[model samples]
Target chain A: MSTSTTLEAPKSGTWDGGNEPMKASYGKLMMWFFLLSDAFTFGAFLIVYGLTRHAHTPYTGEAEAFTFSTEWWPIPEKVFNAFPGFHGVDLPLAFVALMTMILIFSSVTMVLAVEAGHRMDKKDVEKWLLWTILFGATFLACQAWEWTHFIVGTDEGMLLPDGTTYHGASMAFNQYGPPLFANLFFFITGFHGFHVFIGWTLLIVAFISTVNGVYHKRGHYEMVEKIGLYWHFVDLVWVFVFTFFYLI
Target chain B: MAHHIENDFQQTAEIPKPQTKAIWRTFFILVGLTALEFLFAFTMDAGTARNAIFIILTIFKAFYIVAEFMHLKHEAKSLIWSIIIPLALVVWLMVALLAEGSYYYESITNYFK
Candidate 1:
């Protein structure tokens, strides 16, 4: 390696998101590139979560001395454990686990849809697309329910001396952790939920086009493969969110 | 012109039929990893070691998704690095931000608590 290197711009044979030297289409490559940038944004938000969580450690000297204080961070299991149709039941991480399964299953359906597209089978593509949309919708519904319960927090929050309570989840506070906890939760989960909705709508369009025999006339399912890339990328981000936000 | 365009489309070679079994295998691996994460979560208390394990498993799932589901593993090396290198930078960003943020957290707690 030399410290001083001459710089030159190549006049030919360059790949700049448009070139096909990678054997992938421009749209597919761009989608990957865009996801890469999106990953950084989500990563930054999670890092902020880590930062705030670290700041709010509990008093850990002795049992008698340690009393409930406003600064201590809330435990994960204690914060999120309510399941749908289970009134006041304690199911730690069970419902979120179900949400994870739904999301992962949707990813599988998406890949199958892409596979059908590869085989130029419009009927199978439409079938798989429908399944993917259903799974995505189900995941969204679960998230909505989780959010509702989160805001309605089953935990009866203590009254602050300042005449307000840290109930459920809000910008001001939550019974969970510090004030920042609720903010980070809403930002990260809300962003990921928005992405799922986007993918779901795109999939709807792909399904409709497949039903109209559009790929049949075109003799290819490039559209399906392209959308598959996006869908898979969304699933990949959720893996991180699941780990950092929910499980960990 | 329409006939010419259709003829041009045919000239481009297409890959073999869909690989459904391969995807099923990927799905099983993802499910297995998730199950392992849950097992760890339930068995172990929240500590540095558990956090490390969670991060590693999460990254493994991320790799599987990118390489297998996104098909980047089969793509050209240059293309793979073009995306991978930037993603690595994001990891670096995490380290940097977390370090500074931890410092701030320490200072605040020391003063207030």
Candidate 2:
């Protein structure tokens, strides 16, 4: 049996790019287009990040001369090591791991929601959508806490040779290493957080429509499926961000 | 509750609850990958090898997300290539930019000395 019912040609008709290209609706194709371009933007951001890291080492000049290294990039392990409510304990990546898990779980919830859509189960779709929204919101709350900790800074600031002190991440002063690290962190994570907020809002819209019987009347849940695509794309982006910024 | 109990052929065919075994399997795989990633962060020191391992795992997770969760794997071959083909350029962009950036860095360090 063929994988797609729609893609199977009529008994013997000439093939043409019909209303649905390769069995995908216009909206689905458009969403894929938007996601593809968005991926390019993220690629550019990460490439720039790698570029900066290549240019700037921990020390300024050669080791023999030493000569006051201007580019003092901090090791990521040092800056992002604390867990919420566990003061004085260094949990390097536990919080981020939790956040990653939460987001991955949300993606799973979204897949279940889409699967429910395929079965035309409005109630189950709504239930799973709500769960996804809850997971997404939890991830956002964790990010807010991480940002707050970074700003308020439990760790003491580092001292430069000139008697100046570098405090926790601001655009100007970076306690971690160079100010650039802080700037990238703010830009990358802040940008990603904004996407999460938008995704949550979209989930609410989908949930409302599901509750209102919009899809039930239409006898299909393609809208839920479309939103699922967007939601999963967000999780995919976070996977890359987590690998590059946090791990490496 | 109105149309739910009807014995209409189409309605009966569209079961209200589909088996979710695949979904549960997917969840476990993704979570397991993440658990392994977390373990790596703790056990392994940062370096090229560690970074390579992270990237490989990330690619695995990405494949699972796109193929399984997004259901693109179920779609037609043409549609899959339409998206993947353009993304290959992003890889070229990274290599080009980073190589030039590193070259400039080598010059800058030499000049500073």
**Each prediction's fraction of true contacts recovered:** 0.73, 0.79
Model 2: lDDT to the true structure = 0.83
Task: Please state the error at residue A172 of candidate 1 in Å.
Answer: 1.7
**Over the stretch B1-113, how does candidate 1's per-residue lDDT look in tens digits?**
33455535433546456768888999999999999999998888777899999999998999888899888999998889989888777778777877877788788868788
RMSD of each: 6.5, 6.8
Model 1: lDDT of residue A126: 87
* The candidate that achieves the highest lDDT relative to the unseen native structure: 2
Error of 1 at A219 (Å): 2.3
Where is model 2 more than 4 Å wrong at Cα? A1-19, A58-70, B1-14
| Model 2 docking grade | medium
TM-score of chain A of each: 0.86, 0.87
The whole-model lDDT of each prediction reads 0.81, 0.83
> How does residue B59 of candidate 1 score in lDDT?
84
Candidate 2 structure quality by residue, lDDT tens digits, B38-96: 88877786678888899999999999999999888989888899899999899998898
The per-model DockQ list reads 0.57, 0.63
User: Ten consecutive residues with minimal summed lDDT in candidate 1 chain A?
Assistant: A60-69
Superposed Cα deviation of residue A133, candidate 2 (Å): 0.7
- For each candidate, what is chain B's TM-score? 0.81, 0.84
